[model samples]
Target: MKATTARGTIEAGDVGEGRPVVLLHALALSGRLFDPIAAEWAPRRRVITPDARGHGGSDWDGRPFTGEDMADDVAALIETLVGGPADVIGMSMGGSTAVLLAQRRPDLVARLVLADATADYGPDRVQTWAERAEKAVNVPREKQVDFQIDRWFSPSFVEANADEVRRVCDIFVVTDSAAHAAACHALGTVAAVGELGTISAPTLVMVGDEDYATPPAMAEQLAAGIPDSRLEVLTATRHLSLIQRPDVWPEIEKHLDA
Candidate 1:
């Protein structure tokens, strides 16, 4: 779970014991966000969820970063641990990093699951995200919690599972805003779409029906680009579908187990 980095020893919480699978988390969130979902992938498959560079417990180098840089790190993680290729699942911004890894070093990615991610983060989206991050930095932590809930969860889900939703929001508020802005910039100039079809991985593009962040349209766009890929939509869920709707894992399990 720990890898020696040029900067320091980076840690990733790993579990399960089958084919190696790497879990990349979303923007404004750390790898710990995957713990709940990681359980389903474990006990049968080896799942390694790392705190993305500059997020979670990982030391920030104070360097401006990009998704491509994160992708390069992941490709190396796979090569070092698995000795070659491995299946990768990325959620939200993590999905962008996943694709970048596959495209830049196809030999390191065996299969890809892009969940709640979009290829083109246009100017508008980047600006909005950047503005939001800017607004969040100076605001009190309490307000940041409210903002995350509104953007990432459905009202009904939050009402029914307020405590659980709060924990997810807590993670968001404590995350470094600057790191998020850097990732936003990375996605804004993202260019991995062209080589998607070249990916040999048996891929799955997943989204939640109630996901407001990246809707079904985005998932469909991914399926169209990744040759022979399939799409799975989790119902009655929001942006964090994997955590909000537990049923989503069976499909993911099927993908990994297959």
Candidate 2:
């Protein structure tokens, strides 16, 4: 389904029937990232998977946007679709956006889950992100697959799941370069740590012990900052642990069902 928001037209997958559970995707990925999860949870919940602006089927006007801006876009979508508070689960870049959403529009989020995400990227983030953005647009997307995959999954998992890794790589290569750059810039600018204490919803912060992109240390920051939150670390997992290890779903389900 598609909804018009002040930012742009936001497209999403709205499936199942019951309380809504919004699954936000990672950078350079789309709502399709949560297809399997959505299907599994559909029997008991309404799953909403939206493509952040500039990714997937969503719209982007070439202008730069912030995590806060993306959160507001989500806020508008929730108002149009869910009509009230819903459980929000975000991963990677999506997790960062979720943090902003909970802080800016706490009323729209009943429960929260931040997977392999962070509130800040530290002092050198600006330059670091700018360099990544430059590389994203200048370097051919296909060439970056190995670099991205290595960071997203552990070596053992990558060797064991060739087909699944290929699928995610396909998505990564096809994503718009400009959009990817913009998202990189947005992530680099993230400094939501100070605001984490303001989130009122029950929250769960999860990360893979092997995750290097956001790292478990970042997850600890999120868990510690949020007043009502807990942290769970997945052993032998990497950045995209949710996909790399679907068994982690039960842990997320437990938090949401609570």
Candidate 3:
């Protein structure tokens, strides 16, 4: 289904019949990234997955946007669809957005799950992101697939799950360079650590032991900063812990049910 928000039209998948749970995707990916999670949760909970503004079926005007803007988009989504606070699970970039959502619109979030995400990228992130944005705009997406794959998955995972890896790669290659650059810039500008204490909802900060993109230290920071939060590090996983380690769902399920 589609909902008109303050930012733009947001395309989402709403299924099941119970308390709502919103699943947000990582950068260069869409709500479709949560298909497995949606399918699993739909039997017991309402699963709502919306494509972040610039990726997948969602609309983006090629203008620059911040993580807070993305969070507001989610805020509008919950108000229009769920009609109340819902459990929110965000991965990577989406994780950062979830933190902003909890900080800026606490009423819209009940339980929070941040997977492979960080509150801040540090002082050098600006130049780092600028360089990455330049690459996204200048380099062909196909050329960058290997680098992304290596960063997203562990060596064992890539060796064992070729088809799944390919599926994610296809999504990455099709993403518009401009949109990817915009998201990179937005991620670089994130600085939400100081606001973590403001989040009142129970929170779970999960990360991969092998995740270099948003490492375990970052998860520790999230857990330490948030008033009611804990950290869990999945063993032998990379940036995409949910995909790389499906067993982690029980932990997520435990948290949600708590």
Candidate 4:
């Protein structure tokens, strides 16, 4: 389905019933990436998954997108669709968006799950991200997928999950270069660690021990900054731990219940 937000229109997959739980996806992926996790939660709570602008069925405004803009889109979705505050679980870019959402509209977020996200990439890493953005925008689409998969998953996992890797690559192939470029810029520009102290919602910062993009060290800093927060490290997983390790859901479930 689609929801009209103040910024533009967003495509979403809303399922189940009861307390609302919104799942945000990473860059170059759509709401469909949450199918496995959403199905698990659907039996107990309402799971809302929305494609970030320019990624899926959502409309792209033909401008560079920001953390604030993406955050507003989620806030608007919660307001118009869920009709109230909702628990949010976001990974990668979505995780950054969730952090911004809690910072900008604490009233709209009941609980927060920041998976593989960072509050700040700092000057050095931000520069690195900018360089990556430049390369991503110029590289051939196939090489782009190869570059991203190398960073997003561990080598062994990639070797073992060819079909899954190809499925994800398909999504990356269709992603608008403009939108992807904008998302990369947003990551480099985000510096919200100081603001994280003001977030009042109970937060869980989870990261894969093997995640190089947003490593456990970053998650440690993120958990430390938030007053009511804890950090969990999933072993043997890379950037996309939720997809890499479904066994971790029990731990996530326990955290959500708390």
- Per-candidate Cα RMSD to the true structure, in Å, reads 2.1, 0.9, 0.9, 1.4
Off by over 4 Å in 1: 6-9, 123-126
- Where does model 4 exceed 4 Å of error? none
| Residue-wise C-alpha lDDT for candidate 1, range 1-258, written one tens digit per residue | 578654355568778888888988887788788888777668778888887776777766767676688888777677666778888999888898887887788888877888888776654866766676566456766667776677677788889988788677777777777666666666666756667777777888888888878788888877888886899887766677667767667878788667
> Residue-pair clashes per candidate, as listed?
3, 0, 0, 0
Summarize candidate 4's per-residue lDDT along 85-201 as a digit string, tens digits.
999999999998999999999999999999999878776857877787787679877878877887788889899999888877888888877778778887777788899898999
TM-score preference between candidates 1 and 4, better one:
4
Candidate 2 per-residue lDDT, tens place, 104-158, comes to 9999999999999998988999999999999999999999888999899999998
lDDT-best of 2 and 4: 2
lDDT of each: 0.77, 0.92, 0.91, 0.86
| Alpha-carbon runs more than 4 Å astray in model 2 | none
lDDT at residue 199 of model 3 (Cα atoms): 94
Select the stronger candidate by TM-score from 1 and 2. Answer: 2
- Among these predicted structures, which one has the highest lDDT? 2
**What is candidate 1's CA lDDT for residue 6?**
44
How many residue-pair clashes does candidate 3 contain? 0
* TM-score against truth, every candidate: 0.91, 0.98, 0.98, 0.95
